[model samples]
Target: MAVLPGAEPFRHEGGEVGVLLCHGFTGSPQSLRPWADRLAAQGLTVSLPLLPGHGTRWEDMNLTGWPDWYAEVDRELRALGERCSRVFVAGLSMGGALALRLAARHGDAVAGVVVVNPANKVHGAAAHALPVIRHLVPSTKGIASDIALPDATELGYDRVPLHAAYSLRVFLRMVDGELPQVTQPLLLLRSPQDHVVPPADAARVLARVSSTDVTEILLEQSYHVATLDHDADRIFTESLAFIGRLAPHAGKEGTATVG
Candidate 1:
């Protein structure tokens, strides 16, 4: 299947500090392109990978599952770990869950974690029925591009693949169980108005992560896709500050160190 224009994975080899970025479930890297470019401009190496089963039609997502998506991001994280002295993981929505999983799994290898509207669980009566519903339904309404800015859109499928969504739910629960293993510095950004993920999701992560250095930001003007909404610049700027604080010599030109 042909990848949609602007949905391609992005990589920039810039400096000794690397940031691995993951896109949300069913979402292409297009949703994080500007965020990646912003970090790249600061001379940090960046990897924004298109998760498996994404960047194509909605039906294609049904052929894949959360493990496939996690593997793709994990590969990028390992590649970044090889080249950079410090590596951080960040993501939006399901990508956030993946980022936390990386932090949990890798321990000190991940220097920090950042997430925007990270999802950890599904709710409502519908969620309770997903395990059975997925066996019968192929898809339902998509929960994409939940941005407050008018005319803004995300390059994701128009429908949610039920089986894939069920996989995501299972994956999130797995991450939730491992949250206490995450010890890296954490930055979580949440939008109070987010329609796709509840505020409790962010709260739960904060409560579970073993990291003492955790900061939470409220995106007053955005929604679930806060990276592309009005608070986009704030997310980029604050994330840069977070990275610089942790890796002060990150973008400096003279070093070729890897840790």
Candidate 2:
């Protein structure tokens, strides 16, 4: 499949500390480019891979599923692990779910995890119909670009592919069941006004994860896409701080300054 402009994956080799960033479902790496760049500028090796079936069209995504997306990120995480002494994974929305799966599966290989409005469970009765509805309909309205910035936009599909969404629900359930296996340091950033993911999702994760070191930061100014919203700077700076605290040697070179 032909990759879209500005939607390509990103890689930066800076130091021995590696960070793998995963973009949300239906959204391309463009959505997290700024965040990746900020991390790279701070002298951390970073890899932001474009999930399969994304950065193209909604019709294409219908042919793909969650397993395909997970495989892509997992491959990148392994590669990063081999190259860096310490590795951290960060993601937004569905990407966050993928990150959690990586941490659960890889264990100590992943030093820490950072997520923004991570989605774990689908709420309401509508979720129950997805298995059948996906076969009847092609897609629904999309849930991308839920940002507070008036002019900011997330590069993503305009519609949500039913088949793919069904796969996402299945993936969520699996991840939720494995949450107790995730024991790495965790930094969760949630937006109070998010319209896409409910707060209960975050609550469920905090309740289920076995991680002893966990921090939750509420974003009062942003929406679902907090990484690209009004509180983007906070997300960036706080993430650097989080990484620094977990792996101080990575931040010892110089202080990260956001312009």
Candidate 3:
């Protein structure tokens, strides 16, 4: 399949530390390309993979579900671990849920985690209907480009595949329960006025996670897609600092690294 214009996966080889960046559901690596580039500029190897069934059409995404999406990032993390002495996983929204899962499943292999407007639990009345509605309705309006900036746009499907969304809900439930197993350092960035994910989702993560080092930042000017919004630089800068703090010696001069 031909990938969309800005939706290609991104990879950068830098120092001995690696950072895995994951895009949200229905969103391509385009959403995190700037983030990936910024980290690469800091001399950190980065991997921003386009999730399975994403970076293409909505109907195509409807055929694949959360397992396929999670598998893509999971594989990327293992590859990074083999090359870099230390690795950190981060993402936006559903991608954040996936990052948490990685930290949970991989344990000490993941040095830290950074999540922006992560969705850990599905809520609202409409969400409850997802299980049944997906069978009747193939898709609905998209939930992308929720930026506070007037002209900012996130590269994602115009429609939200109901089947994929239902699977996301199920996937989040599993992540929520697995939160207690995530013991790595965590950095959570949240948008106060996010329309898609409520404040409660971020709260739940803080309450459930076992990480002793947890930091939360409020993006007052951005919305759900904070990565492409007004506070984008803030997310990028803070995340780099988080990684540096966790892996201080990994980026020193003469450190060896692999692809």
Candidate 4:
């Protein structure tokens, strides 16, 4: 079910703990690069992969659906399992929804999940009233100017594809339905002033997930894209601590829950 045809498995040369980083919608692996590097420097092998149909022409992204994106992350999770004693999965925005799905499905294989500004539901009444009709209407195009990324970072697609947004709505529904099954240790981080995903959406996930070990951190200075914002380093630091807490004991190394 892998999305990438003939793509080889990801291998880590070192590190007993592995982290898989998933980016947001219309976003490339670049959004997670800085966070991945930080984890790698901490001796954890990290994989920040380009989702299917992403990091290319925007039209390609419009062609793919959420299932394809999930398949891609599932494959990476499998590869990470192959290389480490413990694995943690995390994502940003739509990536957060994907991360939650991974934890729900791979409850045994996954050590934990860190979700940053996970978009689970659109709160606006207008968006809710005409969900289908809105997809037919085009919105003004432009990525946020204060995305808080270095000039070299891939900000996002300038033009928001209607079909792509519709696809995300479908995925959010998928995540919402599966939230109760996500019982793994979870860290939910949200930007209070997020313009894209309402903070209440994050609260909904926190409220529904069955996990008892859940921590919610509010980013005062960041926007929706917390991975690249002012609080990004805090995310990395907190996530590292979360992973460390779940790591297998040295004497109990190689002990992991199997699906």
lDDT of each: 0.92, 0.91, 0.91, 0.76
Q: Per-residue lDDT for 1-259 in model 3, tens only?
A: 7999989899888888999998998999989888888887778888999999999899999999889999999999999999899999999999999999999999989999999999987776778999899999999889888888998999998899999999998999999989999999999999999998999999999999999999999999999999999999999989988888888854554223432
* Model 3 CA deviation exceeding 4 Å by range: 253-259
Q: Which candidate would rank higher by TM-score, 3 or 4?
A: 3
Q: Which ten residues in a row have the lowest lDDT in candidate 3?
A: 250-259
Give the true-structure RMSD of model 3: 2.2
* Best-first order by lDDT: 1, 2, 3, 4
What TM-score against the true fold does each predicted structure earn?
0.97, 0.96, 0.96, 0.84
Tens digit per residue, CA lDDT, model 4, 53-157: 676656666678788899999999999898878888999988899999999888879889999999896445544544565456654353432355455344466
Q: Which has the greatest TM-score?
A: 1
Strongest candidate by lDDT: 1
TM-score of 3: 0.96
The 10-residue segment with the lowest total lDDT in model 1: 250-259
lDDT of 2 at 29: 93
Q: Which is the better candidate, 1 or 2, if ranked by TM-score?
A: 1
